[model samples]
Target: MKQVRIHGPDDVRLDEIPEPEPGPDDAILAVAACGICGSDVGYAKLGGVQGPAPEPVPLGHELAGTVVAVGDRVRGIEIGSRVALNPGAAGFGLGSGGPEGGFTPRLLVRGAGLGKSLFPIPDDMPFEIAALAEPLGVGMNAVDQVDVQPGEKVAVLGAGPIGLSAIATLHDRGVEDIVAIDLSETRLEIARKLGAKDTINPKNDDLWNDLGRLHGTEQLYWMDLVDTDVFIEATGSGALLKKAIERGGNGSRISVVALHRQEVPVDFMTVLMKQMRLQGAIEYPERFENMLELLARRDLGPMITHRFRLDEFSTAFEVAKSPDAGAKIMIEIG
Candidate 1:
């Protein structure tokens, strides 16, 4: 078997390892596809987990696979079942530090509790797309934070994978007019394909003026632009956060879904004066099923713009870091 591990800053290795055997209460999966996350890039770039990268450490989480073997006590899932690994559950990838993750060709899940960390998917779904259940779950969790009413204006900052997913989720919720903001025109184009009503590139256009046009108002100031009922901050940019706060309507809800790389200062008065319902979203181990349902219907296949084999991880990582890269980058293992 081959597995990818991070040794130091900008260092990732694909090493040969022995196949894992399942315990009495465990199961083994033949990993099919694993999506590289932004967090994975951060961990790989810094060669650290908390502060800096440690010795050789496992580095993967978003994945889907087929159950190849199961222990005696693993009752719910059987051999040959297609499944998605929920890394948020214990004994999976999130907390376990061993040099094993979805990056490998196979995964040995510990405990009969394996059922708690896995979700079965339809046979028709592509493993590469199924791997998206994890990140899409993140978008679903973010959309779940706010009550986006039908016909109400909604805005999503950042046209990254998560942000685009949030826009699609909002569209599914019947919000027709969605504003997708980003600096990258390529990303904004993808957002438009995902059902975003308007795409704004602040680098070239005035965001406030654009919002005023979207709002159909002749004249508007920064504080006066308040038509958006739900604001989703997916960029983790303090400037976008301030813009979301400044442009949100009274009693609007804001969901901060991005993982901030640094501490961003916020104006308390802006939040206080408008009574904004601001909240943060974490991983969705329990909601993979919900995201799976959405994936079954939505044409989110365009989200994956790049695919690479296990041996091409170096090129894959480079593509993922590129400014012009599309929504999601996937690694397929067979």
Candidate 2:
């Protein structure tokens, strides 16, 4: 067997190793497809999540595979069933310092019968699309953060994978007036495909002006604010936090979905005056079934824009790092 692991600082390798033997409660999956997330890119640079791993660490988390074999104690799940791994669930190595990850052909999942880490997928769903369960779950959390409802207006400040995922989730939840904001026209186009009613390219357009014009405006004391019901901050821009506060209507909910490197200052006075609710969102806690429901509703195959074979992983990583790269970069394994 071959696995992708970070050996040391900037030291990722494709090491040949023995196939894993499953425990009594474990199962072995013949890996299918894995999505290269932004975190995977960062971990590659640092050789681990925060620092170099004591041992070689597997580098992928967004993945789907089929069960090749299962231990006698493994109950509900069976061999040949397609399933998606919960990244938050430990054991099936996912960018964590450990034994393995899903970047290869075979993966050993511990406690497969415990019903904690794996969720079966529809037989008809492609492995590449099913691999999206993880990222889409992230998108679900962002939408859940703001409690977006039907008929409410939304403005997402980034059209990358997470932003686009949020937009798609909003659409799935029946939200109509959705606005996608990004500097890339291409990304905006993708956002539209994912159900963004309108888009704003901040490079040539004023984000505040366009938002106000589309969402309508409300007067608060001497200041005017965009009446958008929900604001999902998918771009990690400190300035956007201030802008959202400045223009966000009274009682509007703002969800910070993007990760920021530095501290972002906020005007608590304005937040206090408007009674706005600001929340931070990260991984999906317990919504694997919700992800499967969304995947059942639509063909997420379109979300995948680029695909590469396992052997061409270096090239795939390069493409994922490119600004011009399309929506989801997938590494298809046999």
Candidate 3:
């Protein structure tokens, strides 16, 4: 079997290794597709997320695959079941747990359990779309963190995969007035389809004015505040924190989901005076399989804008980093 391994900064390799043999309580998944996350790119830059990797580290987490073999102890989950692999079961997920990752042809799941380590997807759903349960799960978690109200307006700062997931989930929840704000018009267009009632590109139009006009405005002492109740900041821009604080209305919730590298100074006095909720969100506390139901219902196939084979992963990373790649880039192996 061949796997994608990160040797060091800007160094990745296709390493050949022996395939896994499932134990009595294990299963083997023939990986079909995997999605490259921003964290994966960051890992490549740092050599490893935890620390420098003396041994090359495996590199994939968001993935879907088919069951090629199942242990006798593994009941209910049978061979040939089309499943979405969970690389997050504490010490069991690919790349995160052991030597194996989904960037390979096949992976072994120890103590394979249904709804725990493996989630069965619809037989008809494409593996690429099923893989999205991972990222979308994080988005759902972020949405849950803020406790979104039904009537409150929302402005998502970044229209990336996770932000789009939040938008889609908001749409599913009947949030009628969503404002998707980003520099990428391409993503803004998709945001509209995903349930963003309004879209804004700061490069072309004034973001503050568009937000104020679309969401309505209230005077906060001397500053004009956007009346949006929820501001999901996924853009990782330090300046956005200031914008959210300055324009966010009283009692508005700002769910910070993006990973910021630098520690930006914040106006605690403003937060205190406004009584706004500044919340940090990460991971999917609620089940991501629920997202599978939404995907099955809406066929969010269009959200996936780019696809590449496992061998062309570098090219895939290039496209994912490119502004024109739109959203949700997948590496198809099966």
Which candidate gets the maximum TM-score versus the true structure? 3
lDDT of 1 by residue, 108-162 (tens): 7776355677789888999988888888888878888786778887788888888
Q: Write the per-residue lDDT of candidate 2 for residues 251-297, one digit (tens) a residue.
A: 99999988776798889999999999999998884768888888889
Candidate 1 wrongly placed segments (more than 4 Å): 95-99, 112-114, 216-222
Q: Is candidate 1 or candidate 3 better by lDDT?
A: 3
Positional deviation of residue 121's Cα in model 1 after best superposition, in angstroms: 1.2
For every model shown, the clashing-pair count is 3, 0, 1
Quantify how close model 1 is to the true structure by its C-alpha RMSD in Å. Answer: 2.3
Query: 1 or 2: which has the higher lDDT?
Result: 2
Which sections of candidate 3 miss by over 4 Å?
none
- Cα deviation in Å at residue 85, candidate 1? 1.7
| Residue 41 in candidate 2, Cα distance off native in Å | 1.3
Q: What's the lDDT for all of these models? A: 0.80, 0.85, 0.84
